[model samples]
Target: MSLDAEFERVSMPLENPFTISRGTQTAAENVVVRVTDEAGMTGVGGAAPSSHYGETADTVEAVMPDLLDAVERVGDPHALHAIESELRAVVEGNPAARCAVSIAVHDLAAKRLGVPLHRLWGLDPSDAPKTSFTIGLDDTDRVREKAADAVEAGHSVLKIKLGTVRDRELVDAVREAAPDARLRVDANEAWTPKEAVRKAEWLADRDVEFVEQPVPAENPEGLRYVYERSELPVAADESCVTAADVPAIADRCDIANLKLMKTGGLLEARRAIAAARAHGLEVMCGCMVESNASIAAAAQLAPLLDYADLDGSLLLAEDPYAGINLSDGEIRLAEQDRAGTGARPAEE
Candidate 1:
């Protein structure tokens, strides 16, 4: 295999506003990668920007120039592996940029091997997995409306964003409107330990599925406290990014929200599941406001996870590709046989 390849970035703009803990995100763009071998095979890859992972877009945009320069310099896709040790060196450990580079390289490698992404990860490509549709923080009435719309739109389970003064109200309203809907809540580090427990108890009264990161991650001891007292199953978000963070917080919560942007990429994220399961923690594959490229990468990890929260793409105004077929909250595989979250060509 020869090394010479070309690199470029394609931005996938979102169609609508994605509301969350941070704020309402109006648009999203992903950096795309193409790898070419001397024998005439090309692989496609995509990456999300940092805003979703709590980093600035400028940071992610800045990271690509250096990463692409190095990739082009390496020449061969196989040689790209040699340059990977320097992956985090350029992105400074930003999961979005690194995730993009990682998958781009995988797409190149998968095409070389002539196999689909799931096969590379030892999973069946045809199995359909259901993902949870999100209900962002809104008016109690609007929360109920969004919840109803999600259910009517084919979502069996829903994840609602909470963690402000309206937390209890929104949860109660949603439960009232969608009584039969399975639900989960994310506080996004909006409450204190004492307050989180109180909120957990409140959520339990509404028969909510579970509360995620009700309190700050800085004090996992509070999570343990709430877990011990509340009837709800506690899940960790923004707290369990790395495998190293798993052991310390695994006992404190029952589930973890794993995002490619946070865990770095599919390779590392694949490793996190085993670590979480060993510590008796479930996994929730989630994302920031990104295109199908980002979600496609996370979809491979969804089968290994107990809960799937990969709805970031559906919230977009327009999707770039038919990356994953999501229906009734279930993700239908796209090019599942290809390696590293089989992403189809962007131009297609």
Candidate 2:
């Protein structure tokens, strides 16, 4: 049987751009993809939104007509290669658009197999994966306070969104607040390699994990500059969107930040992880403001990653569907059993 691609726009307001100091976002402005085959089974896909990462509702919306027009008639949506090709031509490194198409196809395929997405992706394991909660940049006192509360709430790892040149104060506040928590910082292209070094120096060995995308993606030289000088390790976020980047970015960064939005979806993300691993780079799965449909798809790829931050759903003031169990920083597979793309959150 054949499959047809369907697309729609959804807007879910965020309680806050899920503040990490780099920027702000109001809603989960997203593109929802559904691929229904001749057998009446449907697969779902979700796209993550990030204006700072160079994605917008307009870009997502604008890309859809062309994407659906091309892939709608593909003879085999389940064939990963074919779907990938159509998707790359349409969405590519654009994150949001690519993610939806990748997800819809995977969702359809998983539904056909009658298995949880994780099982289909070979990411299912008995133990749940630990997920890092975020601490958006706020006043020194507020940053400490939020970290304390969230850490007490059972999140053991904290990913701090550090804006330009604000690293010292935020890191100090976080360290003072949650001394025992594993810590990483995301610059979101806010700092230069030199500034990143200055920032990482303050918390070099004291309760600091790594620094991500200290500079912008295009400046791999700056990333390498930071990687060579910073006391803490550097990871690539905006600097990496696919497997192709892993080799080019290998020498410049110690880790790679793989977001569902960035890698497109679970399958492509998994392949990206393999490529990252092969280059001897550690992986961290990240997310933007999205629903559980996106989180669950990325969750399947978490086991293969060294770290994860799939808390985008947590930032939602309200989530319509209950997709997965994320208790105390753990993502359990309770929601993976449902049919149709394992996007249990989309069922609502």
Candidate 3:
């Protein structure tokens, strides 16, 4: 079957400036991809490249032609393994770019089969976990307000961004606002091992479920140190990028946080999850600030995740696409009766 591919860049304003330990962003720059077969069936996906990962919209755009060319050259949507392998050979470091093509191809393949992406994989959507709504770093009061707002809006799980000196105060504020919300914290590799341990003590008391990337990915030993002593479970985000990295982090963290943008494709993401599970690590599927064009594809993996932080689309001021239903933070994949990843232009 002949295939045609194309892409465009989109800049989505955030409802609020999203801040992590490293920095803040008021807008998310994404590259959206579409792969269409000769029959006119189309699949949608997006790349929200992170500068922290040495990729930007410019970089994603720079690499798209080659990535999409690889897709067209494969000439078959269901030839996922071949297409993904070729994508890697074409571009070594543009994980986000490759991921966009990957998601698009997967979407198209599933669509051609007239099934949801998860069903294509034989996953039971009922097994999917509820996703966490993130409260980005802000003033303690604003954080508390956001937490309250989230709770009022029916979010039962919340992930808070922490790394400042007043981390405890921020947690305290969130707990005050969302006392019943299942809480998780992401330091984005901002803490020292000792500081992470110390903070974990209070975070544990505050009933935080876990701490994510408290220390930098560069310090594996330090991560091990905190993993051994910290009061809360530690999840490795920065340290765990691929299946290969899972073995290295197996002894360092309790959970392996995998992102589609980081792994470069759906197939690589599954490999990472399997590798993490084989190493006795719980898996969490996370995402960059993305639209449904990609987040919908990520949602297809929810059934396989122990934890999910796929709230990327929730942070956007407006999205031009719609895929899955995350109402009240429930990844309602079973309720979405659409084919493919359920990603379609918003107007649809």
Candidate 4:
């Protein structure tokens, strides 16, 4: 069976400025790829580029044409492992670009089999966990407002962005605003080991679930230091990207946060999950600020995770695709009748 491929760049405006320790962004640059077979069934995927990960829209766009060509040559979308291997051979780095092609192929294969990607992987949607909504770094008042809005929108768990000078104040305000909400914080590699330990103690008093990437990714020793002293569990986001990083940081952090863009695609993410579990670390599936195409693909693997932060698409002002549904913070998979990743272009 012959296959055709196409890709285009998309810019999605964020509902609010997404501020992390690195910087702030009002919009996300994504590359969306689609693969269609002779039968005209199309499977779509998207890449949300992050400069922190050494990926950007221009970089992803630059590599996709050749990557898509390679995908076309492979012909059989069901051969996901071969397709991913072929893509890896064509380029080094550009995990986001490779993720687009890999997911598109998996989407196509799952659609061809007339099943959702999760079921294709022998996963049960009933086992999927609730996802957390994120409140980016902002002033205390705005933080309170966002927390309230998230709660009103049915989010029971809130992931707050820390690392600001007013980290304590921000959490205080958010806590007051949503007293019953479960809180988690991501420092985005902004704190030192000492600061992380101090902050973790403070956060634990306020019921924060965990502290993520409290220290820099390059400082495994620092992370270990913080983890040993932290009153709360420490989850490694930046430090644990692919499966290989898992073993090294397994003893340092309590949990490993896996994102598709970081792992390259669902296939590798599965390996990352297994690797984390093998090391006796909990797994959390995460995503960059992305459209539903990528979020939907990630949602298919939610059952394998101990936690979910798959609200990247929910933070967008206008998402082009529609896939997963969230209700009171719980992620609901598409009906079993729905195929592929259970995502499709939103009706214009």
Which portions of model 2 miss their true places by more than 4 Å? 90-93, 164-166, 339-341, 345-348
TM-score per candidate: 0.89, 0.90, 0.99, 0.98
TM-score of 2: 0.90
Candidate 2 Cα deviation (angstroms), residue 226:
1.8
Indicate which candidate wins on TM-score. 3
TM-score for candidate 4, residues paired by index: 0.98
| Model 2 C-alpha lDDT per residue in residues 16-111, reported as the tens digit of each score | 546655556667777777778888777777777677668887888888777776667575766777767876776665777877877777767777
Model 3 over residues 192-264: C-alpha lDDT tens digits? 9999999999899999999999999999999999999999999999999888899999999999999999999
Q: lDDT of each model, Cα atoms only? A: 0.72, 0.76, 0.95, 0.91
Worst 10 residues of 1 by lDDT: 1-10
Assess candidate 4 and give its lDDT: 0.91
Best by lDDT: 3
Q: Which residue pairs collide in model 3, if any?
A: none
Tens-digit per-residue lDDT, 81-184, candidate 1: 45565676655666777777777777677667776666666776455458888888777777888788888888988888886787778888888778888888
Model 3 alpha-carbon drift over 4 Å, by segment: none
Please, what's the RMSD in Å of model 1?
Answer: 2.7
* Residue-pair clash count for candidate 3: 0
Better structure of 1 and 4 per TM-score? 4
Q: Choose 1 or 2, whichever is better by lDDT.
A: 2
